[model samples]
Target: MEYFGPNGDMYLATKKLKRIAIVLKPQESPAEFEIHFKRPDADEIMIKTEKDAELPHNAAIFHSAKTLVESVRVNDNPKKKRLVEDYTHINDQISTNETAIQDTLAYVNLTADIDKAGTTEHLNQIKELTVSINKEKRRRDSVLAAMIAHDWVGKREELDDLLQSDIQIQTPSTSHEQLMAMYDKLKQKGDQVAVLQSKLQNQLSWVSAEDTSRDDTFQELEKLADQLKDELDVLSVLENQRQSVCVGFLRSNKGVHKMLVELL
Candidate 1:
């Protein structure tokens, strides 16, 4: 008879009790046994035996093999535990990254509607959020590359799906036309203010030079200077208002541009 060891090594036994007992002896034996047994083929025969007869030798060999097998099983347990922990960590990271991306997209969408109503502070906030979004995208990409390298087949599919489903924010184009329009309006207001200022200065200079020589001329010049001063004040106010509008337009445009560049 032949039995397989835990390590897959095979040992032979004979029907003759002496040979069967001798072959099962432990390695540290002194005296040995030799027994003969009939072979499966009628014409053939063989003899085998172990060297030691200290105890039930076959039982000892069987138990030794069992111990080796058990040791291997024990060794694999920790490896399995580590694999589970690693998988859980990867899953959590992916979930967090996906949520961050979604939130960033939402913020981008909300900011898209900000036109004349968007304050400089609001635009600044959007810029900050976009910066965070880009950082998260980089992190997510790094995780995806790692997953691919590790052959994480299930995670690869899930990440691919998330990327595909992600909302892409388009970059806003530079508003050349809008800027030009605001510039034109401001230039016109500035020209009006300059004209009014010049007229006031000319009238005041006339009054100062003619005050002693001609009372009537000096009085007329004073009245003209006062009227010009009033027009200058009005024009200054209009210019300031136009400048404020221009500032708002520029700020909104900057925010839009920043959002676009991040998307690209």
Candidate 2:
């Protein structure tokens, strides 16, 4: 069983298109995660550039994608040219490794079947093929990790742009239907308070300092009435702002979608 991380699909892309590649540099000892992004869709031009070595391994992919976005934003032609060249070279290596891996796996499977049939003829070949498979898999993984990193970075930029946009946030409001519902509630509370007042008046003859419990109950009922009045006031203000606030919210929502599509 092969375990793929969040960036797993990147590795799988190798078999489909010549869009991925990598090169080993034991001497240079690059970061744990380095990725290159090409325009996956042909309508857009693929941009490439050198990755920042200072970026932390966990953030390498996203940061690289930011750099690409910046390049597009600023139209940095010289940097864009360098990145295009690098992208091509890396993809070439990925394509080569992908082919090599596919071929080795096929041979390995063939040899394994033959060995199972009690043929000692392909034993050495199987061992060599297994080693080759491991090597090719590592190379493929590196390439895919890079692609996944680019995806993260691109998405982050889009989100950031949306958040930073100057969309005046309007407070939410109660609709006419909502206000009508609340008005009904307020009316019910008012009726309850009126009933409580009438009961207190009827029981006034029984009131005394030794038993002020009935008076206290009437006071509590009065407070509840005041609370219902306050709620009604707030609902009235919200109802007034409902149309404008809702329109503002809709505009802001559309703006977010527009900004995100621009990133793509």
Write down the TM-score of every candidate.
Answer: 0.24, 0.20
The C-alpha stretches of model 2 lying farther than 4 A from their native spots are 1-76, 113-159, 163-264
For residues 1-264, write the lDDT of model 1, one tens digit per residue. Answer: 744221243454444442321233354222221222223332322223332322244334333333332332211235433433443454455456556656656665677666434544555665665676566544533432332223233454553343345425332343323433543554465465455445545544443331233445544544544554455466556545533433333244544323323333
* Cα shift from native, residue 147, model 1 (Å): 48
lDDT of 2 by residue, 54-160 (tens): 12331332333233323222112464334334434544554565566567567667776656653343445556656765665454334333332333355766434
Top candidate when judged by lDDT against the true structure: 1
Candidate that scores best on TM-score: 1
lDDT of each candidate versus the true structure: 0.41, 0.40
Please provide the root mean square deviation of candidate 1 (C-alpha atoms, Å).
42.7
